[model samples]
Structures are given as structure tokens and as C-alpha cells.
Target: MAFHEMLAPDYIFESSWEVCNKVGGIYTVLSTRVRTLLNLFKKDKIFFIGPFLHKKESNIEFIESETILDSWRKYANEQEGLKVRVGYWNIPGKPITILVDFLPFYEEKDIIYFQMWEKYHIDSTVAYGDYDDSCMFAYATSKVIESLYHFLQLQGKKVIAHLNEWMLGMAVLYIHKYLPTVATLFTTHATSIGRSICANNKPLYGQLSNYNGDQMASELNIKGKHTLEKLAAFYANCFTTVSEITGKECTQLLEKKPDIIIPNGFDSDFVPKGKMFETKKVKARSVLINVIQKLIGLSIPENAFLLATAGRYEYKNKGIDVFIETIYRLKKTYFDRPIIAFVLVPACLQGARADLKERLENAVSSQFPLPRPFITHELVGPLCNDPICEYLYYLNFTNEDDSQVKIIFVPSYLNGEDGIFNMVYYDLLIGMDLTVFPSYYEPWGYTPLESIAFHIPTITTNLTGFGIWAKSKGAKSDTLDLGVAVVERTDDNYFETAEAIKNIIVKYITKYDSSQILNIQRTSCALSKKAFWSHFIKYYLQAYDVALRKL
Candidate 1:
């Protein structure tokens, strides 16, 4: 049969821990793809299943709709004794969502685990921490799916339960056993062993081809999670991953070659256009400058370059160490222009600094150096314990008089109430002159894509899926001329990566004229257009076809 001429699902039920929770990159994957799904199927035909902690907690992302799926909601609750709330996810698509309360399933966790082991050979007895919660949620989600399938009287109808990550793996297993008619697709954003190897400071890319996934999982003490992820990949009708890099990891670490590669795509509706874009950029730059000057008690130059590296505070994995190293190198080698770099990585932090808050409010500048001068927020523990803070102190990248490259650590989530900028991340991202994400271990980088979407040229490593995609589309070197610099980053090239980034920044700040810089920004914006959901949604259609064909 031709690939394009395969069966399509009548009802699509997608589940993720980050459906409306907004935890990490997975949230970006599911939320952004909603509109495309809605365009393919009617709003009522698409359903999103997520874990429901509380109404108060999820009120921001979910709007309870008492009318939609009213019959199945009641049936799942009364007959199945399941707790579920049907609603609409508060995104652009506003698709139907069912947030299932999984707390009740914890009481029968043993039976659930036993059934999983007996049927699918998934061992959950050694699982700890969030495993129980995730499994219970998966069990609840499966019950919801089964109840809905029977209640709707669609026994043989084409239904797909697409689950994301190992957290929702049990849902695939449950559907495989109980609702065998439902086609299942499982996508692992990053395998447990691959992440563990990187976290342990081991060389992942250099030695990836020779590693045994099960052995490495035991060594890393992640056997339970790895087993579940492996089982899901093995049992699902179609197992998939986010990017080509992650597909290789799945093949080596999980021992299962993916049936398809569904790279993540975004909706560009959030990006401002024309004058609005310029206005937003100006406002963001103003806000960023004000915050930095207040925190550092120094008047930054008018032509200072505002650079940033933002994401989760994975010091080594996200290449935060390399970012700091590049800044230090820039300071030591080239001080021709003033550069202010923001490490917008959220860490375990206390609230905003009291003294800094007072200084900002009172418009006072301290002549003496403040404790942890480069950091905006107070650390929860001793400053020496945090890797980034410790490294900054060791390198003396303190925003003192002699240092031309000033670094500010914004160690709080930018959710419009971080007590510092009080602005969301995107509101601040537009202000950046250049963004860098030299990730040592990124499955699919959203930060660099976001930076380019804002018309800001960015530098990322070739290890990332997005970087590889950019390279395929003519990103040749670590220079602003390409708009997106896909720096060659192997496991052993830490210092080399830092040097390459330093040179890129030096070239951009010194050599590029205003018109040239504007052209680079235009190139970045053009590259972002190629990654929109409209261009990338066909890969998802292909994945669905693969799953249905397998069924």
C-alpha cells in the first residue's frame, strides 16, 4: 500500500504530563501542534488527556466545559468510578481536554503493577519518586479511554491513543491489553539512559554506538524507568522520537529503532509583526537594561549588546558552562564593546534579593560590591554549592569595573511574577541582540528556535535536532552571516565549543555593520518560517499513517 493512502483515526486521544501543565519542552511539542490537529479533524474529534491535580492549580491552562462530552464524563465517573474533568485547553486551538484525577488509583498500585508485569512484562516494583504518580495517572487515563470507547459505542472505529514519554507509557500498554482496537503511538522525547549518561558527566555522543542500554540503566540506577520506556517502545504499534539525534539514541540505548521521526514544530502566531515587533523589541531592551543597571548599579553603554542563554539550569547539559566560558573568553580577549549577558536559567532560588529590591526602589547605587554581585536572586543554599554561581565566582566574571563582559544570573522563572523583571520570558526574549544555546545534550532545542522566531540570530550546537535541521537548510558556520550557527560540538570539544562561540560573538559585535546585522536578523526570521506547524505537520500525518498501518 502507498504510504499516503493509509487509514486515518476517527478519534484522536493524545496524552502527556505536560498537556496543560507546561513543564518543559514536551509541553511545547503537544500545545503547539493542537491547531494543526484541529484543522485535520473536527474539534470534537480530537481529545487531549492530562493529569488533574486540582482545579485551582490547572485553572490557568484549562477551562472546564460542562457541556462537551457530558455523557462520557458522567459514565466514566459513575460507572467506572473514575474522576475526570472535561474541558478545553486554553491554547490557540482550544481543543477538547480531559484532565483525569489519578489519586484514587494509588490505592490499587500493586494490582496495576502486577497486571502490567503479567501482560506487558513492565516491572514497576523498583520505581520510586514520581513513577507512582505518573503510573497512576496513566492508569486513570487508560480507564478514561476505555470508558469513552465503550460509552461512545465505537468498538471498531479508528481510534488512536498517542502517548508522550515514559510517564504515559502505561496507557499504551493498557490499550494494548484492554482496548486492542485502539491504535497506539509512543514518542520518547529523550530516553532515560541517554539523559542519565549526560547527567553523570559521561561522554554520550562519542561512545553512543557501543553502549548497552539495559546495562547502562542498571549502572545509572534508572532500571525501572528504562524498562517501562523500553516496553512502551517495543509494544506500541508505532514507536517514534522527536528528532534524528534522539532516534539514534533510542536505537542504541533503548534497542528499538523508531518507526518514524516526528520533529517538533511551533505556531508563530505569538510573534509580533512589523511595528508591533519593533515596539516589543524596544520595550524589552529598555526593561532588560533597566533591570541589569539596577542589579549591577552601573550605567550600561547605549550600544551595549544584550545577549542571553535561557532554559532549565542544566549547568553542563544545556551548555551553560560553555556560555559562561565564552563570556569570560570574550572579556579576556576582546573588550572593544560592552556586552551584558543574561543567564536566564531558573535554579533553586529564594525570592529576589532584598537589598537589590530596595536599591531598585530607592534608586540607590552601592559603591561596594554586593554579595554575589552577578546574581539577581538569593540562593537557597550556600553560593559555593551551586555550579554556575561557583564557576562565576571562580572565574571572577563579576560585574566589576575591570570586567567589560558583565554577566547577570536571573535565577527565577519568568512567569510575570518573578519579583525581578515581572515580565514573562517571551516578553524579555525579544530584547536580545544575540542568543546562544551551545547545548551538550539537547534532544530538540526550542530556545534557539524561539530566539530566531523573534528575529534574533542564535548559536547552537550540531548535537541538537533543531541545529541539525538548520544545518540542512544552509547554516554553514558559527557566524552571524548564517543567522543560525550550528557549531560542531562533540563530547570532548568543550573548550573548542566555547572558543568558537567567543569568536562568533566577536565577529558579530565588531565586523558586522548595522545593515548587515539587520540582514542576518531577516535571515533568522526566514528560517523560522520553515519550522512552522504548516510546514512540519505533514510529518505527524505520516506518523499517524505508520501507526494505523501497523494496526
Candidate 2:
């Protein structure tokens, strides 16, 4: 399709911390939604820019080929003082991508910070840790955009710079200031100060209305990121967030209302079909059971209920604390069926547990449980520092021969070679009967959506973006018959939410009606199909239109 005939911007340039790097949920959003975006524009029109972290080596997800813009690449490399790898992302859409080496920017980042402070009043005086590196990357990405824009002579074209997260907030400000013709869409997945508040164990929901973002940032020592996010949200041609919940967060915390609310959509291709699906599911189950039996030294029955809660290890913010409480509450109940709940949250792991590896190697269930039997891998840090393991220790899980519930904390990433489990996240995800993501401060609950996508019923709280979307679509907010149960989570309703989850699981387990369960699973798959990028891509197009018109 010709540029004039198409409804999309002439070129769509998107930058994220997770473009090629699989850091978090943002990777899921961009990588999965590429196919849908490509349908609107040609492969070259939609450009994704990210950091080059693979040390000049070829990344499995990136295919570096001869440049379509070789002249510009050469000029930018030598003349424009930029370093980038021109490539196509090896994903479903195989879209064009540019992974930039931003390390050189570190030397000039202080000067760049001064410029930002002068131009946008972004405070970076007290920034620490990953702040400098991320800011340098964002600034470098913007410079890359600027150089490419001038080189391509895309001055009068309807171009968009869709920058994601606070990490890319600098890019938004830079494009908005330097390239006025190109519209900028800044999306804050979660406000920095808001997340900091929750991560610091402060009561966010109840005190949100009374809280000032600047004051909280000062109190929490996150003024640099918070200020950049706030100003970016204010000055961008269009500000977008992932969900209604996160949009409200931006309004309250960042003090700028989002122009569009685009929910993250799933890729249907990730799911297998027919015999392949069943085969993977069976293998997943067998692996899960084998790991559990080996770790706990007990024969797990075929009817074991495999429940899990997997994501970043934010014990309170991700409601991992609540998940543990739910398990604790459920264990007190007298359910006849055995429960195998796995905590798949990756952390700073030393490696797979030596004792567990020995048991698995022998392919035999232990006659007795080993020490610290609840975890698959040992942590690099002390047990007291880890909220999950510390809390599990407090709960005193025996993992005995006749225990009702066996909790295994796999504190390592499931990349098909996590020493134990030996399967990737989705492979293990498929075998689960139920999943929970009762997040206290989730921008978008991709874990729960992924669970439902794989036909496993999930229980997520209304606080999440996905949970609110599920509620709006009328997915039995607190029932299992429809596959997803959105539990009502509140600041003070910690016990209530745990009780609700415990009740839901108990009922589902006791129902023992295979036909109804199968119906729920089918309904889950059907619901996920509705949330495919093909359906959700329209909202992105709407955001693009909003940004283009603003210019």
C-alpha cells in the first residue's frame, strides 16, 4: 500500500528497554504486537530501536543483513557519532530493527543530563544505579532517530516516535523538542514514583489521592526518573498507557492523563494446536510432577492440582505475598486432593539445588524430604532477604510425605535449561491447572493473560490492567466456570483476597466435574482469542492517529 493511501503514519519508530532484550512484559507487548502493526505498514515502515547488549555478537532474536539504508548507516557510524546494528528482529513479523551501542554515550551523559535539565527541567542530580545507563540509551536512541530522520529526508512525512516506559522518556522529550514534525507518543507502563511507593511498602491505593508525586519521589529518592516521566507525559504529542488502571496512575502520580488506553494483547501463535498442544501439555505435566516428586520424595498422583504464580519477584507489589497467604489458607482446609503449587519467580540464584539435582539424576522419589525442600535452587543472597523464601520459611512448610500442599520455589529463569524443570516458562505454563497473579500494583498482568491463553484458568485481582479488562468483558469476575476469576484486591483486603482465592480453588478442586472444567478451559482459550493483537491493534492505530493529528 502507498503511504498516502494508508491510514498509518509514514514511519512508526518504537523504542523500548525490551525491544530485543526480554526483560519484562514490555517485550511481550512489542514483540507480539509487531505482526499486527506490520499488517498496517510495510516491513520497513515500522522500525524498532533497542540497546545492543550482546557485545557485537549475533543475537538469536536478531538477524543482521545487508542494509537497505547502507549510506545512512555508514554516515551515522562515522559522521553522526552513532553506533548501531541494522537488522531484522527474528520474531513472528520479522520487522526491521536497530540495536544501538549506547556505551559511548556514558562519557557525555552528564552533558546530556544538563541539556535535559535545562530543556525539560528533568532532575537527575541524585540518580544512581541503572539510571545513567538507561538514560544514555534513551538519549542515544533519540539521536539515532534524529540522524535517521534527517538522512531519510522524512521531514514532511507523518512519522511517529512511540517511546515506551520512563527509561525512554528522554527520547520522547528529545523528539518533541528537536523534531517537532515527528509526533511523539510516550507510554509509562507504570509511573516510577507510584511503583516506588508500593515497592517501599507504603499504602498506595488508600493514600494515592492525597499523595504528591514530587513529594513522594523526594521521600523515596526517585526524583530523576519520576521527573523525566512526568515531563515526558506532559510534553509528548500523545501520552498512552497500557490500561485504565495504569492511566489513572499516570493521572494521579505523573499528573498527566493518557490520550489513549491500549491494553496489551496476546499472540495466538505462541499456543500450539491439536495433537501438538496435547503432547506438550502431557510432557509439561510429567516434567512438573517428576520435579515435585523428586524434590519432595513422594509419589505425586496423576490428579494433583498444579497451581502456580510466576513473574518478577516483587513479593508485595506482584501479590506474591498474597499468593503465599492463599496457599497457606488453602493448606489449612481439608481438601482430599493433593496440591502442587510452584513459585516460578526468577531471582538471584546460585544454581539448582545440589540435593534436588542428585534426586532428579537418580530418577527416584526420596524416602524422606530433604532440607529446604520447598525450593528448587538456592539463592545467592541470604534467606532473610528473599521475601518469598523467608515467608515460606515462616509458614513452616514440611513438604512431608502426606502434606496437603507442596510448594516449590524455582528461583531461576525457566529457559528450557534452568538445571531443574528443564523446560521453558510456556512449556511449564501449559501443564498447570490454575494460575494466580493477585498483583497489588500491576500495570498489565501478562502472566495471567498468558495463563488463560494456554487454556489454564487463572485468578487475578481487579487492581491489574488485565483484570479490569477481563471484568469489562464480563468474565465471571469471581468464578471458575468462565475460566478467569478476577479477585477483588484492595489495600486492606489482603486477607479477604486470599480467602476468596482459597475458596475459589477449593470449590474448583471439589467440583471434580471434568466436563465443566473442560468447558472452562475451552472458554478461556476462546476469550484469549478475542484479545489477539489482530483485535487490539486498532487501539494502537487510534493512538497513532491521535499523535499524527496533533502535529
Candidate 3:
């Protein structure tokens, strides 16, 4: 079917945030689908509803008419109105309108806490409830839906409320009790239990830390999760997840399977593709190379291999520590032939920064330490002095432009400054020899999938969404294959990650001639075409069918 042929009924997806206010992969999933969604559902049929937390202008106005608002306010006041006026307003976008609710959290500031803990790219020493936060969260969820319900009632349009993840799933359960025929569709991008277990193999809090399967199933109210998800699985009109791997995980973990697997795709309008690269921005390329030199304080030879890696901070989970260690290991073997390894993973907290600093220090001292003066300045001087070092310094060190290869950490919850950093990352992506992401807990990573779409080779582990999807398409090997190199995530030390990076560097930057580079690019583009728009959109159509049949 043509891209325009797929249609999903008036689909209204609600989450804590979306692209304009992204904090995780969820934002990437929503934003990348904008073009495809517009083509599928057309205008008005698709709407994204989230809390209004930033510098957003609210134009669509509605008076709070529901008694539920009064009930929410009374409850809020009783709990001291923890969240600051979050009212709802509609923002116009092509193919869909975004309805944002901001009244419940009008004057509050605890968003920093949630953003730091759940969405912030940095690590923190602070605990989750250093302040009273639950009431406010419950309030935000309730009020947003309460406000959204009245707004949709005003529009007189029937909606299939598509709630993503557990927080929004809670809202769906509450909303469904009142409006049973609303045709709700619940999607668990990743189950809470599954993610928490994946992240640390323990419960999020110590309260349920010791509980085994049955005890955990009962103690922290697993029934509540099972109840919500099962209701969605068996009771809701339809259910979906971002990828088939994640969908399967949700079913097995939640004990309730989704009806469809809506794998994510890139927003071709934003990310560069095959023909897009042929129209390269030469100035953008030069600006990036300059930035790289400034960052490392070493000028690199023009022919020196440049490899890049980046993602939100989940350093261990995203396999960044392994990436760094790999570079350290490879540098030992290829010291004579310099290669610039650009690290671009974000760190969420001061603690995470210190931790990364310590790791980098250990790597430097063990492998690349200077002969004289232990101080940071003294050590970097020799690195800046060599003629080959002169090339490295200018190209990798002095080039502060993010487009070039340099270890650049982009922070979480991108706002004014960070948004520019994100754009730079996109620009830098074009110049990369390869991009590596070996995530241990990614439900469906957008990075590897996006890298291929951009015609850049990538490395993703089986633990990621795209890796499993690639395997589905017959991709194999621990080396450079399938336009992606799949590194198995195991108890085996960091050597596997290091080996994969070394192979990619050898295949793309070190060993390959222009003809070989062109072949890799062609393979990447072909793989992208396989994922392009067909496979994912068909799942959406199937979901619509399931939803309509149930309705």
C-alpha cells in the first residue's frame, strides 16, 4: 500500500511528554512518527496530549466545566496543591493538533525531581521522594485527563484514547470507569517491572526489594499493573507497542499480549537519507571538523579515522563505559596509527559526571598518559605538540563544532541550549564513520534504526529494539553485517563491545577504500528502505482493524 493509504481512526495518544518536551526514547518515537502519522490518520484524527510544562503558548481555550475539576482541586488543596496552574490548550501542527494540559501544575517546581530521576540524563544522589511528590503526580495525571475529557466533549469528536506506558495507563483506567464505550487503546512501550528489572535486576525501591515472584506480584500491587494492562489487553478495543520484541516482552511480563506491534520509524523530513547525503552541506562539515579539534586540543590528520557514539545517559545500560574501554583497548594496539573516538553520551548528574571522569582518568593513566607533569594541563601539552598531534589537535581537539568526531555529552530534557546540541548531533551524524549503541535495556532504540536511515553504519546489541528487528530481517554475526553490527550483551567482559567497535572502525574507516565505503552506504540505505514505512504502517492498519472490530 501507498503511504497515504494507511488510516487509523481518530487516534488520541496521551503520554507525560512528546517530542517538543522529550525526556526519553518515548519522545523520539512520537516525533519520528509525526510525518507518517499525519499521512496515516490525516489531520484531526491524530492528537498528542501531555502536560504543559515549558514555554508553550496555549491557544485553544476551554472553560473548566466538569465537577471532576472541582473534585481534583479539593483533593489538591487537601494535599496542599503540590503541583503548580496547569491548564490545557491546543497547539497547531500539520496533520494533527497537540492538546496540552497545564492547569494542575501551575506554580509547582518538582518537575525537576521527576525529570532528574526518570527523564534527566544525569545521575543523582537524591532519593525519589526527598519531597512529597506522589500526590502532585496523581493530581497531574487526573487533572490532565479530567480537562482533556471535557475538551474532547466540546469538540464533539469521538476519540480512541491511546495511552502510552504505565502512568498514562493509570489515567486510562480512571477515565474508562466513567466512559466505557470510549474505545480506549492502551500501549505499554515497556513494562515498569520489566524495565526496573532490566536496569538493576531489582525493584525500583527497597520496599519491594526482597519480594520474589509471587510476593512481588502481591506486595507492590502487581495486580494493579496486571489489572490495568490486562484490562487493556482483554477489555480495551486494541493494544500496541513500539516493536515486536518489546510487544512480546510486554505480553510475557505483563501477562497480557498486545494486539499489534507498531514499530517506530524515522521522520524522513528531519533525518538525512540517501539522496539527502548526496546534497551534503560542505560548510556544516568544515564547521564540525573544526569543533572536533578544539574539543580534544589535538589536530588530527585528515585521514585519521573518526568514530562517533551518543545517547542519553544510562551509561552502563547504553554500553558507553564499554565503548570508552574499547577505544582505550584499541588505542593500545594502534597507537602508531591514530584514530579519533568521539564520545557523545549525556550524563544526568554531578555524580555521573564524577563517575565518568574517574573512568576516563583510569583509562588515560593506564593507556595514553603523558611522560611528564601529572597535572591535566601538563599532560595535554605533549598531545598538542606532535605534528601528527597537530593534525589531531586542529581536527579533533580544536574543532568545538559538535558535527566533528569528539566525545560530546548532550544533557537530558533538551531546552534552549540543549536543543542546539541535539541539532549538532544530527549534523555530526553525517560525518561519522560509524555510530555505536550497545544498550542493555533499550525497548526499541531509535538510534541504530535512525543511523541506518541516515546511511551511517551502526552497532546495536540484541537487547535493543532495532537489533531484534534487524535479526527478524535475517541480519547475523558479531561483526559488521546487516548495515548494523550486533554485539551480544553477556557476562563476558567489555571485550565484545571493544571488538565490535574495532571491527566497524576497520571495516568502514581503516580497511575500506571509497568503493567499499560506497558499498557500505548502499547496504545501509537498502536496510533503511526495508524498515522505511511499509513494515511499521501495516501494523497500524492491523491495529485499526482490531480496534474497529472490537468496537
Pairs that collide in candidate 2 are: none
Q: Report lDDT (Cα) of residue 437, candidate 3.
A: 83
Q: Which residue ranges in model 1 land beyond 4 Å of their true spot?
A: 1-4, 55-58, 363-369
Q: Let me know the TM-score candidate 2 reaches against the reference structure.
A: 0.97
Between candidates 1 and 3, name the one with more favorable TM-score.
1
Q: Give the per-residue lDDT of model 3 (tens digit) for 113-184.
A: 344335322122222331123223323554454554554563444456666665555445545555554556
Candidate 3 segments exceeding 4 Å error: 1-16, 54-99, 102-158, 201-235, 272-285, 335-337, 349-423, 491-494
Pick the winner on TM-score between candidates 2 and 3: 2
Task: Give the candidate order by descending TM-score.
Answer: 1, 2, 3
TM match of model 3 to true structure = 0.69
What would the TM-scores of all predictions be? Answer: 0.97, 0.97, 0.69
Error of 1 at 523 (Å): 0.3
Put down candidate 2 lDDT per residue, 1-551, tens digits, no spaces: 23344356889899998988887899999999988888878888889998999563767878887755678888999998898888888899898999899999989977998999898788899677778888999999999999989988998798999999999988888888888888998888888998899999889888888999999999989999889889888888889999998887888888888999988998978888999999999999998998887777778888889999999988899999899999988878786779989888999989988888888888764777777778889899887788888898898876767678878888999887888888889998999999988899998989988998999999999999998888877876558777789998888899999999999998888864998999999988888888898888878888888888787
